[model samples]
Target: MGESFPMKSGDDSHSYSKNSLYQKLASDTVKEMIQESVIKYLDTDKVTSSMGSTTIALADFGCSIGPNTFLAVQNLIQPLQTKNLEFQVFFNDHFSNDFNTLLTSLPPERPYHAAAVGGSFYGRLFPRNSLTIAYSSQSLHWLSKPPQGVNNEAGIHGSGAPEPVARAYSAQFEADLGCFLDARAEEIVSGGLMFLVMPATPDGLTQTELSALFDFYGYSLMDLADKGVVEKSRIEEFNLPIHIPRLGEMREVIEKNGCFRIERMELTNPKSKVAGPLDAANVVTHMRSAMEGVFAAHFGASVADQMFDNVVPMTPRIADCFKALHHISNQLFVVLTRK
Candidate 1:
C-alpha cells in the first residue's frame, strides 16, 4: 500500500498545505465525535493494564497536514492527561505527507510525547500489541491504486458502473481494507479501540453526494480534454484513487477479517453548508488541498493544473451538485474493538 498509493508528493506549492477551510469546517465535528468516543471507550487504567502497562499508546493513521492533526491529538490526549497515563503518540501517514509541517506546528504545550511513523496504514507500521487506540478519518476509502482499465467517465459512482468496473473497485477495497485490519490486529493490544470516520456512501452501490463530487471533478477534467488542455487519453486513464463505502460493506470487511468486533456505527447528518460564496470557495480549496498533489503525481502537473483551472469556474455549481448528494449522511463514524 505504501509503495503503490503514496499521497501526492509533499511540497508546499504542489502539496497539501495547512488550510483553514478544512480546519474550521471539517475538523471540529470529527474532533467532537472522536472525543466522545474516547470518553466512552478509553477506560485508562483497565485498558492500560490490559496491555500490562500504564502507558497508553495512541496513533492517528492518516494524520494529514497541520492544525487538524494537532487538534485531533490534543483532543485525544488532553482528556487522558487528567487520568494517570503516559503516552507514546505516533502520527502516521504516507512518506509523501508533510511531516515537517506537522512536527513544527505541534501545540506549544502538548499533553503526550509525540513521534511519527511514515508508512501506509494498509501495512504494518507498529510492533505487535503496541497500540491501544488508533484513529483514521476522511480516509480509508482510497484504494491502493485505481481499478486497472476500469473506466467510469460518465459518472463517478461505482454503483452506476457496469459489472466489471464495479467489481474491480469493490475487490480492490476489500483487499486494501483486509490488509488494514490484519495489520492493525497484529499491532493493537487486546480490547484496544480504533475509531474510523469515513464519508458515507448511500446503499445499493448507487451514487451519493460524496461520489457526485467526483462526478463533477471528473467531468471538469474531461471537458478540459475536449478543449485540448489535456490529452483525452490521460483523462480517460485517470480515476480518482478513492471510494466511499456503505456502512454494511465496511462492517462486513471487519467481520470477515476476524480480528475486530464492531462496537458502534453511526451516520452523521449531511455536511453542514456555510454561506453560499464561502461554501463554494471552501469547497474548491478543500478539494484541491487534499487532491491536487495526488492528481499531479498520477496525471502530469500541467494536465492536473488544466483540470483544476476548468474546475474553478464551475465551483459554484458544486453547491448544486452537493445539494444533489442526499446520501445516508454527511460522515460515517464507526468504532471497532480488538476481539
Candidate 2:
C-alpha cells in the first residue's frame, strides 16, 4: 500500500488543494477531538521519562497540505505549550506527497519544530517508543489496493457490489488495519495516545451518498467505455483504494490488536451545510484529487481528465458532502491509549 495518490495540483479549475477546503469542517472536528484528548491525558495521566522528555514527539500521518495541517498541529501544540512543553512534530505521507508546499508554507515561528517523514502508515516509520502522540485523519479507509479477486466493477459502491465482492473488500480492510495497528504499536510508547478520525458508515448502511456518488462515476466510466474512450476493463481495474469502516468495526480492530485501549469513540459531524453546487463541486474535486493521480498513473492524464471533465456538473445529492460536515453522515473519532 505504498502507492502514492498525490492531491491534484496546479492552480487551474479544481485540484486536491482546492478540493481540501471542504475538509476544513472535518478538520475542525478532528482538531477539537485531539485537543480534548490532550486535555484528558494531561489531567489524569503522566508520561514516563522516555515518553515525555523535554520535547513531546507528535506525528500526524496522512497530513495532506497546508492550512488544515497547520491548524491541526497548532491546536495540538497550544495546550502543550501552556504546560511549558516543546514539540518535535513530524508530518507524514506517501513518498510522492507535496511536502514542498507543506514545508515551505510553515509559519516563520511556531511552538513546535516540524519535519517531513515519507512512508505508508500501514508499516512502521519511527523508532520504538518514540511518538508521544500520533494522529491520522481521513487516511485509514484507503486499502493498499483494491481487494484481490473481487470484481468490483462499480468501484467502492457497496450497493453495487455482490456478497462475495463485499466480503473481499472487508477482508482487505481487516488486513490493512491490522498492519496499521501493528506498526503504530511499535512506534508509540506504552502510555502514549493516538487520535484517529476516519470516514465511516453507520451499521447496516453499506453505502452513503458518497459511495453512491462513486458508483455513479463508475457508471460514467462505463458510459465512456461504451464509446471506446476507455476500455471497459480499465474501469474494472480502477477501484478507489478506500473502505469506509463502521464504528463497531473500528472498535473491534483496536481491541483485537491488544496493544491499545479505546479510551473514547464518537460518531458525529460538524453539521455544517454546504451552500450549493459550488460546494457540491468540492465533493467531485475532492474525489478527483484523490483518485485522479491513480487514474492518470494507471491510464493516462488525458483519460483521467476526459472522465473527470465528463462529470463537471457532478454535485453531491445533498448540500453538504457526506465526508464533510453533513449532518446525516457519520464522522468517526477514536482515541486510543497504548497499553
Candidate 3:
C-alpha cells in the first residue's frame, strides 16, 4: 500500500526516499581524510592566531540531515578551536530537506546558523568571498542536469548496455563541474579551502562502467518484478542520474575557473572488516538510494521492492560487490585551496 521506494517529486528531481548506503560508508572514509586535509591546508599563522580572534565562516554545500555536516564541521573546528578561532557555521541543502531534522542534530551549545536555500549549486549562494572554508561529500557526482543525449524516459536498460549510457552522462558531468567550480570561486574567500569527496573512477569517466552497474541492478530489480511481489507503476516513473568525474577532468574545470588549486588528491576504498554479511548488504543498500529511482522507473514499484528483498538475502553477493569494488576502484578525496 505504501508508495514505491523511488518516489517522484513534483519538480523533475528524482528522490530516493531512503538514505544512501554508499554515502554513509564514503562519508566515514572521506570525513577522516578531509579532517586531515583541512588541517594541512589552513595557513599556519592564521591557524594559530585565529584560535582567539578570528570569526571563521564555514559552509557545507549539499549538507543533508546535518549529522555529517556537523561531524565535518566538528572535525574542521576542533583543531582550529584550540587556536581561538570563533566558528560561525552554515548548512546548505535543497529547500526540500527537513530543516527540523537538520536542526535537531545540532548540539545545543554549538555556535552556528542554518540556511534553507532551495536551488542547484549553479551559482554563488553567499556574498562574494564570504566563506572561509567549504565542504561537500558524496554529493558532487549528482549533476544538475542529466547527460546530454540520454533520455530518462527510455530507461537505463537496453541491448547496447552501459557504454552508451555513461558517455551521455559524462558529457553532462563535465558541464556541471564547471558550474560548481565557478560558483565556489565566487563564494569562498581568497585563502579559503574547499574539500570535496565523491565516488569517482580512477580510470577516468567511463559510461560503460557506470552503465554496467546500472544494468546489473536493473536486471536484479526486474527479477523481483517478475515475481508479482512489488508494484509495476511506481518503478516505471522513477529514474536516477549519477555521474562520476575523472581526476583530470576535474582538474581542467578547477583550472579553468581559476578560483582554486589542488592541494591533495587521494583515491581510497574502505570496506567493513566486520564478519557479518548483512553489514555489507547494508552498505550496498545505502549506496543504492542514490540509484534506486533508476531501478524503480525501469522495473516499476513492485519489481523494485522485490529486487530489494531479493538482494537483501544474498549476503555473499553483497560481500562480493563490496570486495570487488574495493579491489577495482578507489573513491576520491580532493582538497583545493582558493586562489
Best by lDDT: 2
lDDT per residue as tens, model 3, 1-339: 112222222222222324443455666776666777767778846533543336787888777664556667777677676665566787776665556666765777775554555445656788876778888886787667555555443344322435666567666777777888888888877768888887666664343234444545556655655766544444454444566666676766677777789898777664442243225555446545544554556565555656666656655654554454545444678899988
lDDT of 1 at 210: 53
Model 2 whole-model lDDT (C-alpha atoms): 0.75
**RMSD after CA superposition, every candidate:** 2.8, 2.8, 6.0
Q: lDDT (CA) for every model shown?
A: 0.72, 0.75, 0.62
Ranking by TM-score: 2, 1, 3
| Model 3 spans > 4 angstroms off | 1-24, 44-53, 111-116, 151-162, 204-213, 224-239, 272-280, 288-304, 313-315
lDDT of 2 by residue, 1-339 (tens): 647777765444565656676566677867766787888874323664655476788899888766577777788777777675678899998888888877877888788889999988888999998888888877888788777776755564545577777778778899999999999999988888888887788777766656666665765677778989998787777666778887888888778888998889887664443443335565676778767887788669998788777776555443443443344556788888988
**In what order do the candidates fall by lDDT, top score first?**
2, 1, 3
Give candidate 3's error at residue 71 in angstroms. Answer: 1.1
- Give residue 66's error in model 2 in angstroms: 2.2
Cα error, candidate 3, residue 323 (Å): 2.9
CA lDDT, candidate 3, residue 204: 42
For model 2, the stretches where C-alpha displacement exceeds 4 angstroms are 10-13, 42-45, 156-158, 273-278, 314-326
Candidate 1: segments with Cα more than 4 A from true spot? 2-15, 151-159, 273-278, 326-328
Total residue pair clashes for candidate 3: 18
How many backbone clashes does every candidate have?
2, 0, 18
